[model samples]
Target chain A: MRNSFYTAGFSEVMHEVKQDPREASYIYTTTACNSPHRGLSAAIGPALFGTVKSVRALGVQLADSTGGDPDGPSPMDLALTGIASCGVTTLLGGGSARELIFDGIEMLIEYGAPDGEPGQAVRCRLSVDGVTDEPLMNELVEQMQTYSPNMATMIRPVPISFDCLVGTDESTRRQLTVEAEPITDRRPAACRVRWVSGTQLVSYPNGRRMLRVDQPKQLTGVDWGPNPQEYLLMGLAADVADQLGRVAYRLTGERHLWEVSTSACEDMRGLLLKERDVVFLQGVTCRVVVPETLRAETGVEKILTAALAQSEVRDLVSRSNPGGVSLVLGREG
Target chain B: MELNGRTAIGFEEGRSSSAKWFDDLTRVRFAGPVSAHHRLLPRELSPETLAVHAGTYEDPVTGCVGTPVFQTSTFLLDDASYSAFADGAMRDVPIYTRYGNPSQWAVQEKLAALEGSRSAIVTSSGMSATASTIFALTNAGSHIISAYDVYGGTYNLLREDMPSTGREVSFVDPNDLAAVRAAVRPETQLLFFETLTNPLLKAPPIGALAEIAREANALLVVDNTFLTPVNMRPIAHGADIVVHSATKYLAGHSDLTAGAVVGRRKFLDRIWAQTLRFGGTLEPLSCFLLERGMKTLALRVERQNANATEIARFLATHDRVAAVHHPEVGGPHYADLARDDYRGFGGVVSFEVRGGDDAALAFMGRLKIPYVATSLGGVESLVSMPSNTSHSSLTSGQRASIGIRPGLVRFSVGIENVRDLIDDLNDALNGE
Candidate 1:
């Protein structure tokens, strides 16, 4: 006997075994599937794939090979890629998404490794570019934080475990293991690695390297206090390059090598101690080595002037104290 | 009243006309050779001498021979055409005070000339200038390589705030050329440090750092706050950008807080745009004060430098002093960088007192002339214990690793009578 039942705008029992064999079989199946229109999936899937493919295609090869593992990108390199890619993608896709036009995009990334750490200890820099409107550009940059995958990864702290081994001799072996808590607090985390012989390697997860005993030769004449403002340094340089490049391209329709190099010194003690409010004394020196042809067409000073005037990050880091509280921690032997 | 035709004609038509008055004022204040002074001086003079003379324009109204304070906040335009001039649509026109005023431009011109930079922009405070520069240069998700030890405010901005915006920073030792080179990736943008560090007084080897930064294709930024341009010119040593916390030494009076970034015109233009948008421009009155302060900078800094050197020497020999960290006093090998990068020793000295924090604080309390305060680069001497004062926020372990002991004292020497200063220090250290 066949029976009919109605449930919330649908007929359940109407699909009886003999009357609706296919519908009953579908309901009984273990695997559930909801199919979309072929045309829609095909169009949307390709567009998404194309967007990601375009981003990956724009990668630039780093010239140096020492900082990271030989086989893969170092944390610093990954960070750079992450920042650059996020900026580029956000600027490009963000503008298209919002129905705006952007002539060009430029980004710069900078970071520092902490003492006794194999990866980046400090990460700071700026990203500046010309857009249609100043306010709109700022809004896009702000919104990008919510969407940038790489940036999201950086803000979330990851659990880190370290395994240290000493002695080069095959027969001799010593291992030290330490696990650090997730870095939720903004204060610098001081961690100590005690060498079996009582040698201490102090590491600040968020602070910079002041001195290293293993590499004492490199510590000569360095002021450990006035270190660089990590992000500001990169921002200044990148902005300079961007401005110079824009001027050059506008004037000559060609892109030239526009580079900036920056460095600073800081008193390590002041940063680590609670006495000095200012720690690193950041300094940036840029040499815009332009092609001779472009240099001739656009006065070097003029180009440089435009570049300096155009830079925003240089103005910010050089202007005020971006606010924060300082904290100190102790590592015991 | 008798109507005199001759006098009326003279006043209204020819000799005493409004045109004549305008022409006379223009000749004295804005005529050919006088207006040319702005462009010519920067090109012809050396930075050291220019720092002293760049903005000493005689007052048009009073002939004061010093840059006068134009305290007005707005300017009256001559006609409706001035609207375009005010909005940067026209060049070389005086329009609004916010865009550019005579007083502000005078200081800007002086700073640019003194730094031997293409141009410069002034801001309300040191940090504002720094922030403007950074904002102009970078956007979200950029990379930078920085020295490990940095100003606390800047450290926090980079470490905590910048990451939220997608920017990343790496801190490394400036002295480590290999490390600096290693730190640079394809997207690395800039490197930064100070010419002479504050409090700790460590000096970086600019030449080597510049070389490393160049190889990595990054811009080098030098903070000339402590040393001032009088002691060191980072540009001459291959710096791309130079910044100063003018509140400390450049202003000399402790009255005004200002900052400046000096670099090539191309880069400065970007910074200028950011400054305008951010509204961090230095007021005209502050610019006048800065100009006034600059006139005596050479004299004040010279005396201050001498005083600091003397004090550093005195502290080195003191029985209460354990170790002095002045770059000049250290061995040739220890401070070889000072010889290469700096022309003179700066006015900051860091030393460890014999006693710990309690005794250090007591010594500071005993001092009469030197104020026991925070902030350096004032005309009056200042002293403070780092472990308890400047770096008190840091953890004890962090302090120990960096060699900041509880007994450490950072002294900012001023241009006061050296004999009296020495006597005050002696009494304090001797537990008077």
Candidate 2:
């Protein structure tokens, strides 16, 4: 019963990880969080805000600053949650070597209330299934506390530097909304598309500027736009360019993103596909161009590579689809 | 040093990114009200607003204004998660798509508000919903009571399919409250009927049937496909479960096929379990379509209802039309029975042509506007002959028994101009 946890989700992953070592690990990042905007701090004024990466997310203390009114989870509470989460994750990871099967794990963490600095003392009560030997369990818990990323952050405090996006004089923010007409028939995959910027997919048949889809030259299409594979490459390039532009803005004080172009070629012979097998792109190449002064700057190539590396879309598409694909063709009623 | 052969996270000093274009999150249009889920009283809003606003929440992760399709299988989990899930503390994170998705939940929330129920689940198709609901509530040798006239798909499920599954069923005339009451057995698990009967378009006394179900200690499941919640809520009339082929009026367009079961949390959970096993859950794309279409549910139903009422009136008096089967125009008895839940007479109207099967075919063939299809409830008008469509599988005797005549033509009215539809029908009726 305790061993069932391993089979609950890891059966395929275990199989895949065995085949490709890359499958053994995954990179997960939360988008952004307003964690520092706690009750009292958020109540009176804007609290420390942070984005996922470089952006130090700040949020206003949304309630009474006197800590009088109750609000959501405080920064300390969130830290505890993270600590609990990291502890559980580390225990799970570290326990894998001991042939332990964790059917369930529960943790109760208590800390002293904050007066000024509060007390550094903390207590933890943990219950997990499948740990029998007391000495081995004690060692495993010790390793979890010592090696856990967030736990280590507590044990060895790392200096956090603030980079406020709004502190810049040229700080600009915009939220874009787009609306698309509902697909009338899914078989042919037709839908009206529009963005808040007034870019409308007015490409219906017989209408003005009606555009037909373009697949590979072999595949039949009107060739109005690039194929989906080409679009993918373009997307990766565009994302990397966006990141580069941001970096460039910080470097040269230039907000204008003049031009960025990308090209890619793919052999779809493998991807003309079944449910399990479909490979679209064979190789992709991205080229970035900047002003001569900025191009000649020190570590420009490194900065460009870092921006490219931060492009999540490129990273996502670089990997294989674990779930595979299913395509269905049907008729209109 | 690599643990397996993968790149280490220390490399996250550089990596990849995630961003979505407008409204392209899943295939769902983000047209729903921003915080329909947070409202304390969604019912207080008109059906027009509730349909558009209910159950939609902004995504906290992507800042997606609409629900995004979480399309994945087997959410990879570590030991704590594995242990928790294995031990039964299942969290909100999806384990697989076949079980559920955020897209499904978004629409399910709207359906609950639409049906006035506490909980709801989306299925792959209307039949899957019915099958899941029936099989969920009934065990082997359990009994079911149905009104004789129902959608053919349901008729196939109840009358023929359930028998092989060791479930006995009895189909009584929907209007005969006493007969429906008498058919109940000690083991009867549910009283199944549409909010508005298909083809014939008569409304059953749901309040009375709810009483019968209460007396027999059975559940009341109403198929609200024809008359969407824009019309009347079956749960308000004591229905334990309200089922819908979201493919119809709720999806307004014929683009998507989805089903919903809304009712008490316990009952819906049972049905959800059935859905998981049956693997008949709605996909994110379909759920997205259903969500978009439902935003216009009350509006579409209003137009279709108004259109049908006008067309039903025209058909009842036409010389070439021998009989028009609608809640209001069918007969006073039909009208009387329909009063319990008839907001509008709905879009479907069945009529008998003057000259039997040939004349029905002739009428259908002469129709210039309505498409001759076997399905109903679309933006455009659809006309089908019962002898050839719904009752095509039944023998003439069985068909006649259910009041499905050789000349019977089911007309699902559209939101077209009433004069155009009337003129088109008149031309078909007068020709040949």
- iRMSD of prediction 2: 23.0
Q: Worst ten-residue run, lDDT, model 1 chain B? A: B20-29
Q: Listing every candidate in turn, what is its Cα RMSD in Å to the true structure after a full C-alpha superposition?
A: 27.3, 27.3
Tens-place lDDT per residue, model 1, B22-77, is 11111111111112323336545654577667855545447676666767766555
> What digit string (tens of lDDT, one per residue) describes model 2 on residues B79-144?
433433432223223445675555776787778877776568889999999999987776554578
Which runs in model 2 stand beyond 4 Å of their true positions?
A1-333, B1-41, B73-84, B87-91, B330-332, B338-340
Task: Give the Å shift of residue A137 in candidate 2.
Answer: 21
C-alpha lDDT of residue B391 in model 2: 77
- Tens digit per residue, CA lDDT, model 2, A243-327: 5555655666654332233433322211111111212222234444443444445545555555555543333334321211111
Cα deviation at A332, candidate 2, in Å, is: 65
Off by over 4 Å in 1: A1-333, B1-48, B58-63, B77-94, B331-333, B338-340
